[model samples]
Structures are given as structure tokens and as C-alpha cells.
Target: MISQNTIDTVFETARVEEVIGDFVNLKRAGSNFKGLSPFSDERSPSFMVSPVKGIWKDFSTGKGGNSVKFLMEHSQFTYPEAIRYLARKYNIEIEETEQTDAEKAITDVRESMYLVSEFAKKYFHNVLLNTDEGQAIGYSYFKERGFTNETIKKFELGYSPETWDALTKEALGQGYKLEFLQSTGLTIPKEDRPFDRFKGRVMFPIQSMSGRVLGFGGRILTNDKKAAKYLNSPESELYHKSKVLYGIFQAKQSIAKQDNCFLVEGYTDVIQFNQAGIENVVASSGTALTPDQIRLVNRLTKNITVLFDGDAAGLRASIRGIDLILEEGMNVRVCTFPDGDDPDSFARKTPYEDLVKYLEENAKDFIQFKASLLMDEAKNDPIKKADLIRDMVTSISKIPDRIQREIYVQECARIMDISEQVLVSTLAQLIQKDIAEAGKKQKQEQKPFEVHRNQKPKYTGYSGGDPEDPRNGPPEDYPGEPGYPEQQQVEKIDILYHLERKVIEILLLYGDKTEVFEDVFLRNNGEGEIETVTEKKEYKVFQRIYLSLQEDEVELSNTLFRDIFTGLIAFYHQNEKFSLEQYLMRLQPEFAQEVTDILMEDEKVTLHDWEGQNIFSKGKSESISQYVTETIMSMRWFLVDKIIEELKSSIVSNPKEDNMELLMMVMDYSKLINSFSRKLGRVMSRYHT
Candidate 1:
């Protein structure tokens, strides 16, 4: 367990913007910072970080929290792992409570795999830089490829020794588990014994976006016919080849700053371009580009320029990826090197200025590239040219943004010297066909399950009818028919979600403010009938909200929200002043995100000028007492309404005399609901005017 003192120190020292900036590129948006969401693919910035609150919210994914929660969500770290990571980053001394042996035994498997990979990376790198065989073979190989010493070390280039069991034996000697080693693909297990997977190959470490070493890519030095030339780490929990980009850890900052990314095809291509002073580049690690990889780039920038080799095969490879990028709603530009060269060779042969100038001068819009490439093959043949136009339309249809698709169509029309109408019509047909195919595929994937009545068990002497009988269902006296209870439960959950959230929001924002509230009571003044009395009572925001819910014996329906509410009430009982920062620090990551979202929702709304658009005319803090009372009343009214509906359903379904009592209860609840509804309406009416 992390000590509370250490957690406090970490929160005080750690800056929200600084921690999130390590992974996302945030720019100042007034008092806050805004960036594209690292959790989702989006063009506009929806991720906001507030230094004052020490919290961040990604509106795209609805995940928000303090700095520690951000790390946990983005890095998939456990709570303790996230705390330790923040402690290290902020240089805070961690005073931890000692755990038992059993507690320590349940350490996270993923973190262990991470540890083994980190050790393997260091071992391979040390071997390359210090050992004679590694210096001679690995160091020499990198130098031969025009990579300077600084570039090699910057990328953490390494070499595995030629001996089969060198890494495996060293890891076991160091107390590292063989299970972790095999899981990371650092050591391959055989029937007899385990051996190093990358023996005799120069290694390239594959890192996560946060720069943790997940796995390695190794290049075989020998020209043996049976062995593959290049091999990557097998898919593991730590390394997913399709979801990762080669230089994302190095290039994410530059990609965000430049608002563009250069897509390439190999590890060397990325390193070479960075060495040539073009920093915002990532490679697909020699696989077909995937939507996951595209989303990774989309988090940093909305524009991508794919660099293709001038050769025929590279051109074909580039064409296959263009549609995927377009479908993601990114602006894609295509740049080709001189026909004989790839990005690696070209970057090596040219000076920095010449290389940069070449890309700037030659990068063409994807539509233009497609038209130019295919026009040559079509060559004035009317039939072939028509087919080429249809092909272009197919690519256009893949685009999710209609405006971009239209612009591409117009460009194609101008280039092909054809009417825009024809191209537009063709694109429409292709889009409709795509939608139909998608719907068909969804239906095929979701086959309905057939439930047989004979499979159900029959219960004896139950008030409700037999389980297997379709018509005899629940007894008439039970809660309305079969589906009514489920429908009512769904309605209650949906209603309570927003209502409970509103109450929580009120307490979080203005919980410490003291306000005057009107309380109604009944008193007898030496008379037969009791006289109604209205008394003014002063209470803190938190006290009023807590008492209102307590008075009704109400608890939130959602487990996470209810837990947060219970914690808030407990804290209010102890502390006179509520501190959001301190509260967030003590919160568990799962619930902390929920609190952060509630706290940051208003800030984001204000930042985007949505608050001033007459959408929510009543400010939450304008009339504190009224706001709290209305919110609590709204929830009470909703709950009462739900009860009335359930009681009415029962009264109609059950002919028993017990229903007379239920009908009276429903009548009283309806009267209370009406009174509350009218008061809420009056409050809303004040806002509208």
C-alpha cells in the first residue's frame, strides 16, 4: 500500500499539464490546456487539463481524472503502478507500508513482463556497446547503414550474442522468472531448455507510446537461405505489432508540434529521417497499416503524408494504405522518392536541406497521386480511362467526411476532363453499397439465441405461474406482467443516473458554501388543526444535500456513483472545508475518473462557449440554495413518480384488497410529485426569462 503522506506529496509536487504533456501535445486554451484525446480518434481537441483542479478530462472517451488516473488510463497501469510512476516523475520519496508475502505474491503479471523486457533491452544494449563481439558485429552493421553513433544510441539499438543461451542464462541468474522471459518473447522455451530468441541478431527495441520497452525487432546478420532476414517479437501482452508504430515514442511530440506525421515503411526509415532533421516520422514496422496505428497518429495530428519508394512495389503498398487513412478522416498526402530510392536510401544520400526541400516540393494530395499514377496506365484508352475513374470513386467513397470526399471528386473531375455530376453519382452508389454490406455483415455476426421453455425449471406453490408456461406467466397479484418490471427497472436506472449525477455535481462544486434554506414544519398553537410554519435554516451546501438524501433514505443506484456519494458524505462529516485536489488524491482510480469528469465537465463547457449559448441559462452557482433544492427535489420527484407507476401497475394487476393500501400510497406520492414538479418548473422559468 502507498503511504498517504507519500501520495499527498506526489499530488502536491506533480503538475497536471506536465504529466499529461509527456504523452499528449497540449496547447494553452485560456487558463486550461487542450489536446486531441489520446484515448480516442478525433480531429478536434476534446481532451482538457486544468491546473487549478489538477485534473484532466477526455470528452471523447468520457475518461477523466487527476494526473495519476491519467497515467493509469493511458498506460494501462495498475493503481500502485500509476502511483509509483508519478512518485518517480515528481521526485517524491515514496513511504510505503510493507505487505505480507502473500500480498507480494500477487504482483501484476503485465508489470513483470515489462520488467523482463526492460532488463533484456538493457542487456542487449550493454552487449552492443561494451562487448567485443557486439561492437564488431552490431555496431559495425549500424555504421554501415549510415546511422551515426548518436542515432544508434538514441534509438537504443542493441545486439544479441551469437550463443544460443546467453540471454536466457543471464536472465535466470539475475532472479528473473523464465515465465516472464518467455512471455516477452525474449527467450524461447524448447522441449529440453529455453534459448534466446534473437541470438546473433542486431536488435531494435520496440517501445510503447510512453517509451516503455515492450519488445524487440532483430535483424539476422547471416545470409543463410533457410533463416528469415528480419524477425520481430511475437505478439504478447506487452507488444502488439499491428497496434504499435516504430518511432511513435520519439515522434509523438514532434508530430503534435508540426500538426503532421510522415508515414514510412521500416525501422531504418524512421531513424534515418529523424537523423536528417525531420523528426515527426513513424514507420509501420514492415506490415500493412492498420486502423489502430492510424488512430495513434490521429491523436497527435489530423494530417499525414505517406512516403513511398519510387519503385513499383512501394507504390502498390502506398495505394493499399491510402483508403484506410481516408476512412479515418485524415488529410493524407503522398510523396515518392526518386524511382530507384526508398526513404532510408534517399535520406542517407541527400543533405538535410535538400531532403526537406524534396518532400515539400513533391508531396501531392492523395487524389492527385491516384489520378497521376493510373492515368499513365490508362493512356488515352477510353475504356481503361472509364474503369480508372470508377476505381478512383471507390477510394473516395471510403472517406468518412463528406466534404473531403466531395473535394476529391471535384479534383478528379477536373483532372479527367469529365463532368462533376458523373463522379458524384458514382461515389453515391459506392457509398450506398458499402452501407448495405456493413448492415448485412452486422446481422450475420449477431445471430439470435433460441431459448426453449423445456430448459427452464418448474417451481412448486409459487405465487407466480409455472416458469415453462408462456401464457400463465406471473400471477395477477405479482408486480405487473413479465416485462413491466424490467422496463420499470431500466427507466429507474436511466432516470437516477442523470439525477444522481446532478446532485453529486452540486456537492462537489459548492459544498462548503453556507446558504439559507426554507424548511416547512407543522406546529400546533393551542388549536384543533396544526398550523403550517415556514422557518429559515442556514446550512452548508454539503450538509443540505446529504440531509435531503438521508431524510428519504435514498442511495444512488450505480455502484461507482453511490460509492463516491458515500465517501463525500463521510469526508464532509470530518472536514469543514472540502479540497478537491486532496479528495482526488485519496480516490481510487476508477472512481477518481468519475469525479474528474463531473468537475471538468463544466470547465470544458465554459471553454467552448457552450455555457453562454443560452443552452443552460441558469448558472449552477447563481442561486446556490435554489440550485441544490431543485436538484434534490428533481430526484425525489422522479423516484416518487417511479413508485406511483409501479403501484398503479400493481393496483390494476392485483384484484386483492391489499391494493387499496397501494392506491392510497400512490395518491399521496402523486400529490408530492406534483408539488415538487411545480417548484422545479418555477426555478426553470426564472432561468429562461
Candidate 2:
């Protein structure tokens, strides 16, 4: 467990804007910062970060929370992983206590495999840097390839020794379990005999977006005719080749800053670009481009420029990747080098400025590049030219945006000297075919519903343990009750649910501030007569809200609202000076999400911009006391009205002779409702007593 002092220090020292700025490009918007949503692709900025509140809200996707939650959602880091990342960013020393036996035993499988992979990465890096053979072979090879000592260390390049059992034995000797080693594909375990998987090879560590080592890709130094030149770690718990992109950990910040990514084919291309002082490059690591890999880069930026080798023959093989990028709604441009140069060789030999200028000047949109490349093959041959036009139309049809697709068709028609109508018709046919194919596939995959009479329905959130047990049916939910509205949403414009959410919003925003409140309530005067008593008192805003609700026997009807309500109350009760940032950081992700949604409600409204138009709007904080009083009184009246209607229903159902008591009860509640209306400054009153 991390010590409380360390967590507290980290929470205090880490600024939300500074932490999120590493992954996102934020521009000042009034008191907040706004940027394109990382969770979605959009031209407009919908993601807002409020440094004052220490929270971020992505209006596009509705994912809002503190800094730690952003890391978790963006990079898929676990809670502990997110915390450690923040600690590293803020330079706070993490003090973790020794784990008990039970704690160690319960660690997750993927996390265990990550530990083994990390240890292997360190062990191999040590061998490369410290061992005599490694310095002569692995280190020398990197240097020969024009990699600096700094670059080698930045990428954590390493070497595994030639001995078959070297790593396995060292790991076992160091008290690292063999199971995790085998699971991570670092060692091949056979009949209690294990050997290093990447033995005698130069190692390249593949890391996640959060910088955790997931696996390794190694290349053999010597020519062993029977062996593969480059061998990657096998699929395991923590590594998925199709979903992982090399150098994303190092390139994410640069990619976001540049608003573009340079797509490459291998690990060296990524490292060489970085070494050339050109960051914002990631590679697919020899695997064909996958949608998941594109989506990974999509989270950072919506523009990708693919750098291909000089050979024209290889260009055709990459066309599928271009279409995939287009299908993901990204703008993909292609840039190739001169006859004999690739990104690695060009960057290694040319100056940084020239290389950058070349890319900028030569990078053409995918459509233009394809049409130019294929025009040479189809020159003056009418039959081949028709095929080329069709091919261009097919590529254009993959684009998701209608305007871009239509614009490309026009460009294709102009480049091919074909009729615009012909190109548009071909593009339409290809697109219709794609839609038909997709619909057919969906139908094939959607198997007919199976009725398994003996199978019970699954309830993921059910606390009733056994589904097979007859007593464990569904949750005990009451939709008709006042305190539970989720089963039946009561958030209509005329309903009281909106008032419940308003109370929660106020508490979250201004709960710690002291306020004076006056209230009128009925009490027996000790003479068999009821008298209204007026009392004025000073209390914290949260205390006033809580006491008022408790007196009326009312609770927030929404589950999420109720959680935030109780959680905020407990947080305020414990701390003297409330820290909204610190409290938000401590909340569970779901609770924190609801809290930000409530607090940022006003920021999302158009009225917040009235000041910019020279038409100023009233600020809610200026009249918070009156606002709280009116909201609470209105809520009480709404609930009492429901009770009066219930009493009326009783009188109508049972002949009026049996409902005299109910009539008197309605009259008493009616008087309270009229009083509440008067307190709210409303002229018209109902059910006058």
C-alpha cells in the first residue's frame, strides 16, 4: 500500500492542468482550458479542463473526472498505475509498505506478467550495458547504426546472452517465479527445463502508452541461416501485437503537440526518427495495419502521414492501410523517399532541416499520391486507364465523411481526365456494395435468439449471490417510492427529480461555505394545539441541506446523486477546510464522474457566454442563500403535494364516510404547502386550508 502521506503530498503538489497538458493540447477558454476531445474525433473543441475545480469534462463523450481518472480512461492504466504516474510526474517519492502474503497472492495475472516482462527488460538491458560481450556486440551494433548512447538508453535497447538457460536461471535464482516468466514469453518452460526465449539476440523493449514494458522484439546479430532475423515475443497476457504500437509511450506528447503522426513499418524507423530530432512517429512493428492500432493514434490526433520505402513495388502492399486510416475518419497523406532511401537512411544521412522540409513539401494526400503513381502504368492505354479510374474511385469510397469523399471523386476525375459523372457513379456503386456486404455480415453474425428454459437471466449488479437459488431473483427496487427514481425516471420538466439534482449540485459546489437559514415548522405547543415555530441559525451549506432533508424524511431519488450526496457529506465532515481538488481525487471514478457533471452544469449552458456578448447574466453565487431557500421549499411542497394526492385517492377509493381522518391530514399538509409557496415568493397558492 502507498503511504497516506505520499498520496496526500502528491495530491497537493500535482496541478491538474500541468498533469493533463502532457497528453492534451489545451488552450485558454475564460477560466478553463478547452481542447479537442481525446476520446473522440471532432473538429470543434468539446473537452474542457477547469483548473479552478481541478476536474476535466469531455462534453463530447461525457467522461469527466479528476486528473487520475483521465489517465485511467485515456491510457487504460489501473488505479495504482495512474497514481504512480502522477507521483513520477510531480517528483513525489512513493513509499509503499511491504505486502502481506495474502496481498502478494492476490495480484492480477496481467500485472504479474508485466512484472516479469519489466524484470526481463532490466536484466537484458544490464547485460547489454555492463557485460563484456554485450558491449562488443549489441552496443556496438546500435552505434554502427548511428544510434547515440542517449538514444540506446531512451529506447532501453538490450542484448540477451548466447547461453540457453542464462536468463531463466538468473530469474529463478533471484526468487522470481518461473510461472510468470513462461507466461510473459520471456522463457520457454519444458518439463521443469527452461531456456531464454530471446537468447543471443539484440532486444527491443515494446512498451505501453503508460510506459510499462509489455514484451520484447529481438533481432539476431549473427547469421544463423535456420533462425528468423527478427523474433517478437509471443502473444501473452499483457501483449497484443495488433493492438500495440511501438514508441507510442514516447511519441504521444509530440503527436498531440504536432497534431499529426508519422506512421512507419519497423522499430528502427521509429527510433531513427526520434534520434533525428523528429518525434511524433510510431510504427506497427512489421505487422499489417490494424484498426485497433489506428484507433490508438486516433486518440492523440486525427492526422496520419505514412512514410513508405522508396521501392514502388512495396507501395501497393500498403494501400490497405491507407484505406483503413480513411475509414477511421482520419486524413492520411503519403510521403516516399528517393530511389534508394528509406526514412532510416534518409534521416541518418541528411540534415534535420532538409529532412523535415522534404517531408513537408513532398507529402501528398493519399489520393494524389496513388493517382500519380499509377498514371505511369496506364499512360495512353485506354483499357488500363479505365481500371485505374475504378481503383481510384474504390479508394475514395472508403472515406467516412461525405464531403471529403465527394471532393476526392472530383479530384480523381480531374486527374484521370474522366467524366465527373462516371467517377461519382463508380464511387456510389462501391459504397453501396460495402453497405450490402456489411449488412449481410451482420445478419450472418446475429444468430437467432435461443430460448434456454433452464438458464436464469444474468444480473451483473445483483448482490443476491446465487442465481440458481430460488430466493435470488432480482434487486429489491421500488419505482413508486420517492427515494429511488432510476427504475422509473422522474426527471421530466414538471417533476421533483430535477430539484433533487439541483440540491446535489449546490452541495458539491458550495457545501463548505457557511450560510444563515431561517425555517418555519409545525410543533405541538403542549396545549393540544399545533403552532408554527420560526427559528434562524447559522450552519454550513451542506449541514443546512442535510438537516432540512432529514427533517422532511426525504432522500435523493437518483442512485448516483445519493452516492455523491453521502460521499460529499462524509468528506466535508472530516476536513476543516475543504479541498475540492483533493476530495475529487479521492473519490471512486463513478462517483467523481457524477460530481463533475453536476458542478460543470452551468459551464455547459449558453448563458455562461452572455458576458462575452456584452449582455451580462446574473451570477448564481451572488444569491446563493435565497436560491437554497427557494429550492428546498419548492422540493418540500412537491413531495407534500404527492402525499395530498395519495390521501385524495384514499378518499375516492373508500366511500367518503371512512375518509374523514384522511381529509383532515390533507388539509394539514395543504396548509404547509401554501406556507411553502408564500416563502418561495410565489403569488398563487393551492389547496388553501
Candidate 3:
């Protein structure tokens, strides 16, 4: 377990901007930093980091929290791992007591695997720099490829000896578990013994977005015809090739800064571009580019320029990736190297200025690139030209943005010498077919869930009688109560949702502030006279809200809002003071993010500081007593209105003998609702008036 003091120290020392800026490129936006959301694909910047609050919110995904939560969310690190990462980054010493054998045994399996991979990465890197064979072979090979010493170390280049058991023996000798090593794919296990997985190869460690070594890619130095040229670690707990992009850890900042990413096809291509002064690049590592990988870049930028190898095969492979990028709503540009050259070779041979100029001048939009490449094949053949136009329309249809799709269609029509109306009609047909197919797929996916839900017992909570039978109306002698049950599930507009949400939001934001409330109660005087007595009561905001809800037996309908309210009440009972950020630390990430959204949204509306904005006739903070009363009363009014509507509906639906009783019930409920509305109107005078 992490010591509380150590956690506090880490929190105090770690700055939100500094911690997150290591991975995301943040630009100043007033007091906060704004950038593209790392959690989702977005073009404009919706991710905000507020250093003053020590919290970050990704409005795109509704994921927000302090520095620790950001690490946990972005890197998939466990709580302790994220905490330790911050501590290490901020140079804070952890002061936890040593774990016992039982405790150590209970450590997370994935974390153990990560630790084993990290150890192997460092071990392999050290061997490359210090060992005799590594210096002679590995270092020589990297140098021969035109990589500088800085590039070598920046990528953590490494080597493993040809000896079968070098890494295995070293890892075992260092007290690391064999199970973890095998799970990380660092050691290949056999019946009698285990051997190293990347023996006799130079290693390139693949890192997560946060720079944690997840696995490795090894290149065989020898010219062995039968052996594979390159070998990557098998998929393990920590590594999924399709979901990870090579060099993302190093390239995310540059990608965000440039507002563009150069897509390449190899690890060497990414490194070479970075070495040649273009740092915003990532590679598919020789695998087919996937949507998951494209979304990774989409989080940083909306523009991607794919670099091809200047061959027909490379252009064909590169074209396949353009639709995937377009599907993510990203702009696709294509640039090809000179004949007989690829990204790595071009970057190595060309000067930085020339390379930059070449890319800038040659990069063409996907539509233009396709038209230029295919025009030759359809030059004099009208039949082939029609096919080309259809192919372009298919690519255009993949684009999610309507304006972009239209623009591409216009450009394609002009290039293919086809009528614009013809292209538009064809595009429309394809899009309609696409939507129909998508609808079918969606229904197929939802079918199983629908079946399960239908099989389960659903409760309407009706006391008696079939609700569909008009003969059985509401009970004539029904006691009209404030907390009345629903007659049947009606999906009418519920105003109480927003009111309940407001109450919860207020409690979360100003729950610790002391406020004086006026409480009125009925009492019997000695002369058998009923008198209204008023009492002045002092309670914290959270205390007042909790007690009021408890007294009225009111539970928020939204489960998320109810959970947050309950948690706040419980927290306030234990601690006299409340801190919003600290409260967030104790809750789960998803719950904490919801609370953060509520709090931040309230701030955006100038919750407590609305007075200077001239939007409120009265200061909210100064009129705390009235504010709380108004919120609760508004909620009560909504409930009364709901009941009134239900009663009216029931009376109209059931033309039975109990019509007189139901009418009286409706009148009485109407009177109550009118009283509540009057009270609510008075309290909301600042806005309503």
C-alpha cells in the first residue's frame, strides 16, 4: 500500500502541466492549457488542463481528474503504478514500509510483467553500450545505418548476445521471476530450460504513449537466409501491436505542436524522420495500418500525410490506409519518395531543408493523388474511366465530414471529366447503401442484449390491476401523498432530473461552507391552536442537503448522481472540511470524472461568482440560504407536477365510476403544485423576473 504521507508529498510536488506535458503538447488558453483530447479523436482542442485546480478535463470523453488520474487513464497504469510514476518524475522519495512476502505475492500480474519488460529493456540497452560483442556488432550496425549516438540512446537501442541463455540467466540471477519473464515474452521457455527470445539481434524497445517499455522489436544482424529478418515480441498482457504505434511516446508532443503527423511504415522510418528534424511521425512497424492506430494519431492532429516508397506496390498499400484515416475524420495527404527511395533512405540522404521543402511541395490530398495515379490507366478508355470515377466516389464516401466529402466529390468530378450531378448522385447512392448496411449491423449487435432484457423480469411497481385495463381505475380512497408511486412507467419530460443534478452539483462544490437555514414547523399551542414556529438552524451545505433529502425520502433518479450525493454526505460526516480535488482522489476514475464535469461545468457558469457578471440580481454566495431552499423547493415542485400529470392522465384514460374522487385528487394535487410553483417563482426572481 502507498503511504498517505508519500502520496501527499507526490501530489504536492507533481505539477499537472509538467506531468501531462511530457506526453501531450499543451498550448496556453488563458489560465488553463488547451490541447486535443488524448482520450478520443477530435480535431479542435477540447482537452483542458487547469494548473490552478491541479486537475485536467477532457471534455471530448468526459474524462477528467488530477495528475495521477491522467497517468492512470492514459497509460492504463494501476493506481500505485501511476502514483509511483509521478513520484519518480517529481523526484519525490516514496516512504512506504516494505511489503511482506504475502503482500509481494499479491502484487498485480500485469505490473509484474511490465517490471520484467522494463528490466530486460534496461539490461539489453546496457549490454549494447558496455558489452564487447554488443559494441562490436550492435553499435556497428546502427552506425552503419547512419544513426547518430544521440538517436541511438534516444530510442534506447540495445542488443542481446547470440548465446541462447544470456538474458535468461541474467534475469534469473537478478531475482526476477521466470513466470513474469515468460509472460512478457522476454524469455522463451522449454521443457528443460528457458532461452532468450531476441538472441543475436539488435533490439528496439517499443514504448507505450507514456514511455513505458512494453515490448521489443529485434533485427537479426546476420545474413541467414532461413531466419526471419525481424522478430517482435509475441502479444502479451502489456503489448497489443495493432493498438500501439511505434515512436508515439517520442512523437506525440511534436505531432500536437505541428498539427500534422507524417505516417510511415517502419520503425527506422520514424527514427530517421525524427533525426532529420521532423519529429512528428509514427510507423505501423511493417504491419497493415489499423483504425486503432489511426485513432492514436487522430488524438493529436487531424492532418496525416502518408509517405510512400515511390513504388506502385507502396502507393497501393498506402492508398489502403487513406480510407481508414478518412473514416476517422482526418485529412489525408500523400507524399512519395524519389524512385528507389523510401522514408528512411530519403531522410538519411537528403539535407533537412531540402527534405522539408520536398515534403511540403509534394504532399497532395488523397483525391488528387489517386486521380494522378489512375488517370494513365483510364486515359483513352471510356469504360475504365467510369470505373475510376466510381472508385473515387467510394473513397469519398468513407469520409465522415459531409463538407469534406462534398469537396472531394467536386474535385474528383473535375479531374475525371465527369458531370458533377452524376458524381453527386453516385455518391448519394453509396452513402445510403452504407447507412443501410450500418443499420443492419447495429441491429444484429443489439439483438442479443434485447433478448436478454426481454427474458428478465421487469417491474412496473403497480400495486394491483392490469394497467392496460381501463375498467380498473385508480383506487377511489387512494391517499394522495407527496411521495406518491408511479401509476405506470411514462416517459414524459422529467424536470426533476436537472433540479436533482443541480442539487448534487451544489453539494459537491460548496458542501463545506456553513449556511444558516430558516426551518418552519407546525406545533400545537396549549389552547388547542395550531401555530407555525420558525427556528434558525446552522448547518454545512452538505449537511443541509443530505438531511433535507433524507427527511423527504428523496433519492435522485440518476444512479450516478445518487452515488455522488451519498459519497459526499458520507465524506462530510467524517471530515469537517471538504476539498473537491481531494474528494475526487477517493472515488473511482469514472465517478471522479463525472464529479469533475459537474464541478467544472458549474465553474464555467460562474457558480459562486455570478454577482460581478451582472447576470444575477442577488449574489448567490451571499444568499446561500435562499439558494438551497429554492433548489430543493424546485425539485419538490417538479415531483408535484409529475404526480398531477399522472393523475390527470389516469382520470382521462379511465372513464369509470370513481371520476368524482379522481377529479378531487387532481384538484388537490393542482393546488399543491401551484403553491410550489409560487414559491419557486419567488426564489428564482433574479432570473425569471
Candidate 4:
């Protein structure tokens, strides 16, 4: 119930490009900006944004709308949430209509969860910066690790107090619910008592790409024998560990700009890299890599460098994540620090120049890294060495890109001292085995359903009867019946689709074309009495259609043709001289929906990227205006053609050449139809080539 004025202001102030740019890396293309589709896994750019029109279109998925729609689709934000987000971004004050108590109650649950999460972030941050225990422990720990005050605050590093129930009591006192606290995993419940979950740990807030605090990761400082060093919030409605990446909110821009990402294992690793002047780094928070996490980075960059601790066991365990990255078609490289150092320690010990230089010099492609690491363990043992080669081949087979896979095979063969042919043959066998196993599993899953259908045979394409009439009983005698008339029915559907498209195209291309009808008589004169000798039938029809529209007092200027077309025939009975531009300008949403429905009903039509061809100014006002005009003209011709066909049928049925009234109507309709057809034909002639 935000005031209409507030909504308008938000829309006006929130530039579509600026709003979308925060999440997407957009590059200029003609009059629009083009980028890889965030909604889909696309390698090339198909998502477009038109700043002038204030709309965006994802050509790959066919989703297009204004800025609000983009937020709703991309972030799963509700309409009000999108509006509120815009309001906050643009600093607009919102005036909302008062809601009933029941409505407010329903809203409180979701809003309360968000409020509680924000409150916890603030509380943890304040405790770290202001309190004695937080400073003495958490702050001191971070500082010792070479994290400056700015770095600590930038990452929102904080400390949780040691006392159980401290956060719980404070939150409850502030009118926050225990349920919400537990739901976000900030507090835990046990046998009639609840306690703060992250008590006595240094805090790292895990955030969504938009910077909302979804959850936290906390590291314990104590050396208690039973205590786990690091802990994170449990899975909740807002935070799914498998799908979230730590520090993505802060690192997305740098990742996009660099065209590469540095993946690490923990919060300190990320902070150290950022402090070392490398900003395109994020941590998986020590979990197994998930496709959701991969895609999050994939949206920003296609190249990833996984930084592993130098220890052999850690390196061996982390190699599996590299295969996952390859499977997603991302380019991956591996860099291991010296045996004693992790990313954090290594980055802290070396100067920024040296650290960056070391990464650039030492990072190896996944294939070579896997082979070299495995070869060392299998040294001088032929059987184990053979197994190592097979393992490397299997990993290479998972890569989706054929060229990349081939290159890896050659590299692997060279490194392992095997023939290229031998490696290729081994990869083929492994791939076939994988495919066969997958097929067997699928067949097994389908067996139960197949058994249930054994009693009744499923319909195949044909029956024993004559194919001429599919509905009729099969012909008992003819083994080869004439094929059912599918071709004819398909042709009819094609014609219908084509006709509608052609009509729409013409309207969108040339609806604004003007024509002069002069030296035309409205009435024919007889010897004794006055009679109307209607001019060209098409012209008269156009006049009647035009005049009729005027008589109805309908304003057609700036109206979207799709809407006015439906009402125009009726309006044509009274009015004339309705400008096409007026009809197009005022097109309502329903009309736009109808046009889209019709245009997209058949196979997708690719409107060539005029910008790429340097044909027009991208998303210019003139080009869009011309497109709308053509669409209207095309639709008008379609309607006129229908009218002409009906009138001709009427003449043949009644033999009404002598019936002046009938003749006049036929003449008028024909003239209008011809006039519209000629105008559309010219436009089609010009653009179709």
C-alpha cells in the first residue's frame, strides 16, 4: 500500500541500468547493454537492457520487463520487497496506507526474521568493536593475523560473548522472538533453556550477493580439547550453506572486472587476500563445493583458481572439487602454498607483489596438477602408476568442452610418459562405461512403471484401420492405408500463424504511413435523383472505418494498436481520422500481453541484433517508435482482408449486384482493404530484403 507517488518516484529515480548493473556485468551494445544471461547457463551474451525504454529482455529465456520485474525474477523478491529495495537504494521515503491488524500480523513473520538477522549482525559487530572481552580476544586475534581495523570492519568481524543466554536475553528484551532467533540459528534451544549459539567466537557474517546478512560463521579461540575450532549457522529458510559463498557480496565487482576468481577455504583466507590487494576472492566456508556455489561465481567470471593449503592430505582431498569445477565447464587452475602455509598465512607473510607473483607463476591447470600430484605417490610402481594415469583420464573425460578435453589429454600423456593414442583410448573406454552405467540405472528406475502398463498396450502412431480417418475404426483389409491428413492440418496451422505474424509485422513497421484520398465522390448522381456513387471500394471502406471511429468519439491517437483494433471495428461505425500514433502510445498492459502471446506462439523469431550489425542506434526512441507503427499497420491490413472476404462471400450468396445498399457496403469495405494492403505491401517490400 505504498503511496502511488512514492512508487512513481522510485521508478523514475532507479535507472534500469544502474539497478541491474549492481548484479550483472553489462557491456555496451548499440543502444542497449548486453551481458551473459544470469537466469540461464549461457556462454554468450543474450541478456539485454534498454536504458531509454526502462526495460530488460533475456533473449535466451524470453523473460523481459521493467526494472521491478528483473528484481522479482532474479532475486525472487516479492513486489513490495522490490519496491522497498528501490526505496532504500534511491533514498526515497515511502508512505504506505495503513493495513488492518490481521494483515500486519501476517506480514510480521517474514519481516521479523529479516529484522532479527540484521539485529544480530549489528550486535555482533558492536560487541567486537566496543566491549572488553570482544576486543581482548576477537579483535586481538584478527590484529595478530595482520588484519587492519579497516579490514576487520569492512568484513564485519565481531566476537560473541562467552556467557550462555546473553544474546537470547538481550534479543527477547528488545521485543524480538526466540522462534526467529532459533530459526536463523543465532540461538539454540535445549531442555527448557536457550543459549547464544556463537558465544565466545570471532564472527564472520555470511551475506547474500545483495549484502543482506543471511547467517554467520564463527571461529572459536579457546584451545579446549573438546571444542571445534569453527562453526556456522545451521541450514535455515534464509541461509542454505550449499548455495551461499562467503564474501561474494564484497567480491562480485572485482571478480567481474578481473574475469577470474580466487576460491579459498575459510573466512580469514578471504580477508587476508582482500587485505593483500587482491579483491576477487571468496571462500566455500569449508563445505563440499555445490553447483549453486559454482554458478554464483560463474555469473561473475568463468575462470577460477582454487588455493589449497600446502599439506599433502588437504591437497589430495581438495582435488575432487576441481573435477566439479571442470564438470561445470569452468576453467580451473590450482595453486598450493608452501607446506607449512595456508592462503591466510602465505598471503600475510609475503608482500602483495610477491603473493600475486607467486600465484601467477605457480598456478597449474587441473589436469597437470592432478597428474603431477598422483605421479609422485606412484613413483617406480608400474601398477599404481597405471592406475594413476587411468584416474587422470577419468577426470579429463568429465570436461564438457571437447577442445579443452583434447588438450588436457595431450598434456596428460606428455606428463605421464604415455602415448597420446593410449590416453585417448583409455578416456573413450571410461566414458562408455560411465554412459552404460547411467543407462542401466535409468532402465531399472523405469521397470516398475513398465510392468504396470503390460496389460494395456500403449497407442503407437498407427492403428490397423485406414489412416484416412483416424477417428474411424482401423481398416481390417488395407495394410497400407492412405496416411492421415496431417500434412494438410499442419499446413493450415502454419498459414494461420504466418498470417497473424505478417499482419503484426506490418502494423509494427508502418502504422504511421499517411495516404491521400482526393477527387473522390461520396455519392453518385442520377438523372432525376441524387445517388451516392461510392468511390473506390477500399477507399470508401477506409473512409467508413475512419469516419465511424470518429463518430464514436473514440480517441485513437497514441493507443496501442492491438487494443484499439478490437474496439476499432465498432468504433469505425461512427468515427474517422483516428491517428495511429495515438493508439500505439496508450497501449495498455493487456494489449502488450496479447501482442506478445501472438508473436511468440510459434517458433521463436530472432530479431537480429541491429546493434551488432551497426544498423541503428541501440534502443533509440526513433527505432522503437517505427517498430510500433509497423506492427499496427500490419494488423490493420489483416482486419481489412477479413472484411473483404466476407463482403465478397455475401455478394456471391445473394447475387446482389442491383442491391445498392449491399453494393455500397461491399465497395467501401473493398477500398479500405486494398488501401491497407497496398501500404503494408510497400513496407514489407522495403524491410523483408
TM-score (C-alpha, index-matched) for candidate 2: 0.65
Q: List ranges where model 4 is wrong by over 4 Å.
A: 1-13, 16-52, 55-83, 90-110, 440-689
lDDT of 3 by residue, 468-496 (tens): 22223333333344434434322222355
Off by over 4 Å in 2: 1-65, 70-80, 84-108, 189-193, 440-507, 511-583, 586-619, 625-689
Residue-level lDDT tens digits of model 2 in 508-624: 777888877776778767985556677888888989899989998898766767888888889988999888877876887778777888777666643135567777556666666
Q: In candidate 1, what are the lDDT values of residues 44-99, reduced to their tens digit?
A: 99889999999998887677888887776666565677778988887788896777
Clashes of each: 0, 0, 0, 56
Question: Which prediction has more favorable TM-score, 2 or 4?
Answer: 2
10 residues in a row with least lDDT, candidate 2: 470-479
lDDT of 2: 0.81
Candidate 1 whole-model C-alpha lDDT, 0 to 1 = 0.82
Name the top lDDT candidate: 1
Candidate 1, pairs of clashing residues: none
Higher-ranked by lDDT: 3 or 4: 3
Candidate closer to the true structure by TM-score (higher is better), 1 or 4: 1
**What is candidate 1's CA lDDT for residue 437?**
83
